[model samples]
Target: MPDQASPAPVSTAIPPHRGGLPDPRHFDPVIFPGAEAGEVWPPTHFNFHAPWMHEAGLGFERDASGGIAVVRSFAHLRLLVDIETAHQLFDLAPGSRDFRLLRLIPAALRCVERIIPGDPMPGPLLDEEEEVPEEHHLYAATTAMVERLAGQAGEEGQALAEAMRRVPPGPGMFEAAVARCITRFGFPMATVAPLARRLQRLANAHARVLATAAAQPDYAAMEKVVLRTRQPLGADRGWVGGGLLTRAMDGLLPQISRPRRASTAILAAAEEAMRRPLPLEAPTRLILEQDGYRDRLLDISVFWRRLSAAWMTVDPDTTDRREIEALARNTLRRLSLTSLYRAPDEP
Candidate 1:
């Protein structure tokens, strides 16, 4: 987390490949192809997902070639690192390229020695039974802690939800409810403050879109609001990345078969209202029909619990403690809270 006035220059040396395949004989084939095993790989690849590894001078090069060589080398690294360790270090799945790469390391290492003449071969291959990496105990422990916190937060949210339902809908009321959740639940302000603000902003946008569509009853106007209000609901946003919200949406939402179809569906009821003289509440009701608010509330609740668990798992005296804290702080900063709330403007 120490500020470097200038970032270290990235190596432009491409990893050596034959027939567009990574040459396993080369040291650090996935990252620095011509360099030795002890040489440092570029830190850029792990900048976001595995910053601890980057700080430790371990990480592959970010390559886009999609060649067999890079893939093979990556597989080798994954096997070398093992699954439980990889998970603790970075978000990786058993079906991931890293996981699948384990099968290729032995062959790759043998080929590497034949090509390089004196390069050290990889250690003996792991048996199939041995290949199954151990569970990430830390994550398991963290999840237990998170569940306890979530139970407490969920009760607070339930209370707020009850109060919220009783009050008539009005401007700033949703924001007030969100503020109350943060205060009553005792969620970390550094993280929850920004997320609550974003939820409020999205609620405001939803409200505005409904109001505008109801008042004007035009497809073009409604479409503009839809486009303007659309927010990124994916893993690219930090903290939310690899979290429950990302999982729920990725698991539940149908794949994009056509451009803007999902967004259109979100506004479909509003579009219908454009042609029919429906009640003022109709468009907003239709928007809620998609369960957007419900999902968001769930996401908010889960995010805090996960973050709290992560905080609980860290030990201040550990070697990577600073890195862990830095990672958490950086992710919180990148939660994109600042961009969420905006003044309503003509679309």
Candidate 2:
């Protein structure tokens, strides 16, 4: 046999672990979806407008100082009735869920005429004539919708529908939507493809976690996905104990029958914990301290810890775990990827 080259030296080099997690820099850096190559996050431009508001018969008035005063509308009372019906039917969060569930608008309008009777909206949405407490209106609206839904699907089905609304119909919904936007709207594919891929990866990871949790409910595996999505590999510092994971667990407090004061305290502690610094190398810490970027560092740190705690301490058997997980995934969609490029704030 031809002389075989000497066996390649088995160089043994172990990856660094910071605070019990692998250095974030060692793995592929987590890119934010919809970001273009070389573009800085929190883009320089902030002047954006929603023409949809005008399309919906809403107009904004400017005050003496040229700031927006109030959103005024001369739309018919029928439109207001439809909106109120939709609000209750969907349990819409003010800005977030309202937009995501617009496809149900037509359904909401049809249901309104049947469920809420004739329009009486020449006055304000609130009514003091109703013999109830200050917050009774809120509950009354929600209760009416729930009762209607229960008639069709029963109470359990209504609950399941409510929980499922937090997420879209499928894992590919986001990617498909982006692809459609690019193709139909003439958006440049070159810039959007990378973002779509990143989002696809995130959606896949989330789906895997959900699938696995359905059967096994592995906290360690869930934590890995959360950390990988939130932080890059081989970074100077890594996530440690009880940070964002703790915060996410705090969100579950309302589901339990905890006292209001105790819930508030627990939430407060989670908020404080999220702001604590990550475990940094001694030299890196010294440099950051010397550079007067401590506050900026803290802000940047917030992004690194963003989704890491999402499923921590979660009970797989919790009645609303699916709902909470959907909400956590929605966070990635709603928030900007501001931490991808961490530059020190100007002093």
Q: Specify the poorest-scoring 10-residue window by lDDT in model 1.
A: 125-134
RMSD of each: 26.9, 26.9
How many angstroms is residue 139 displaced in model 1 relative to the true structure, after the best TM-score fit? Answer: 39
Go through the candidates in order and give each one's C-alpha lDDT.
Answer: 0.31, 0.31
**For model 1, what is the alpha-carbon lDDT of residue 88?**
41
Separately for all candidates shown, the number of backbone clashes (residues 3 or more apart, or on different chains) is 3, 12
Each candidate's TM vs. the true structure? 0.19, 0.20
Residue-level lDDT of model 1, residues 158-254, one tens digit each, is 4444434443445444456556656665555555444434333434434433322221112222223222212233323444233543343333223
Over 1-63, each residue of candidate 2 has an lDDT whose tens digit, in order, gives: 999899899966547443233333332233323224684322222112333432433322223
Clashing pairs in 1: 22-69, 25-112, 75-101
